[model samples]
Target chain A: SQKIEQNSEALNIQEGKTATLTCNYTNYSPAYLQWYRQDPGRGPVFLLLIRENEKEKRKERLKVTFDTTLKQSLFHITASQPADSATYLCAAMNNAGNMLTFGGGTRLMVKP
Target chain B: NAGVTQTPKFRILKIGQSMTLQCAQDMNHNYMYWYRQDPGMGLKLIYYSVGAGITDKGEVPNGYNVSRSTTEDFPLRLELAAPSQTSVYFCASSYSTGAKTQYFGPGTRLLVL
Candidate 1:
């Protein structure tokens, strides 16, 4: 069976530091990977997407790297702030390009 | 633009009861999807529609039915709700598949007793 896994443990960091989150998957080959930020009682918002052919993608203070060989993806938030505290989800689009497999997600808390 | 919207922000239902969860998108997207998130778990796709009158089962579609009579609306129907059906349901849309960014709605929280 295909599976996606995240740390599941909450990550705490001081404001202005960098936060890194990991997503690992098995038994699946994806065309692309995406990151999303979800707040309490709200829907997830699109963050960044990196294609299989691309090594990394960045948007402002956020960056994402995809390693198809390792079947893993890393999401980074630089200059993190208190407002960056939320659950970050990692999703991979299946090779068919019709569905997405999502990891449980890691919660990040930035303390000022 | 009201990217996507779901009705009945929250609801509680008795076992065996039935209800419909409504979702609408004004962005004129070609793809719409329904997903359910359980506590501490990632979202699970229930069903998806490629266009009006075109619906297909996704990762988890049992106990749920959906209809897309119009491009702007997709509603999920729950028949004989079960305890396992308690979850936070989300509706999302994207202009197209394969790397397109999906816009999600606030979500609808449902509790089955």
Candidate 2:
């Protein structure tokens, strides 16, 4: 069976610090990995996407890294703020772009 | 644009009941999908539509049905709802080509009593 795992621990950090989240997968080789941010009582919003061949991709305060060999992806939020507190999800999908397999999100709490 | 919207933000249904979760997107995205999220679990795909008329089953499709009659609407129907059907249902839409970023609706919370 295919599986994706996250830290499962709530991360707490002060504002202006960098937060890193990990996602690991088993049994499936995906061509692209994506990250999403979900706030309370709301749907998830797209954050960033990193292709299998790409080592890193960045958008403003967010960055994503995909390591195909390790079957892992890392999500990072730099200079985070209280408004950045939310659950971050990692999803993987193959080249066909059909369905995505998601990992249980990691909750982040940024204290001011 | 209103983006993606789902109706009946919350509902309670008895066993063997039937209901339809409505989803409409104003973004005119070609790809639409239905997903269910259980407590502490990741989002599980129930069904997806590539276009206005094409639909396919995803990882979990049992006890659920969906139809895509137009580009803006994709409704999921639940027949004979069971206890296992209790979950949060979300509707999403995305552009078909190149780096598909999905926009999700607020979601419908269903509790089967």
Best by lDDT: 1
Note the chain A TM-score of all models in turn. 0.96, 0.94
Q: How many residue pairs clash in all the candidates, one count each?
A: 0, 0
Candidate 1 has an lDDT of 0.93
Give the per-residue Cα lDDT of candidate 1 at A38: 97
lDDT of 1 at B10: 99
What is candidate 2's fraction of native contacts? 0.72
Please give the range of 10 consecutive residues that has the lowest summed lDDT in model 2 chain A: A92-101
Give model 2's docking category. Answer: medium
lDDT by residue for model 1 over B4-57, one digit each (tens)?
A: 999999999999999999999999998999999999889999999989999999
Q: Give the number of colliding residue pairs in candidate 2.
A: 0
The DockQ of predicted model 1 stands at 0.89
Worst 10 residues of 1 chain A by lDDT: A92-101
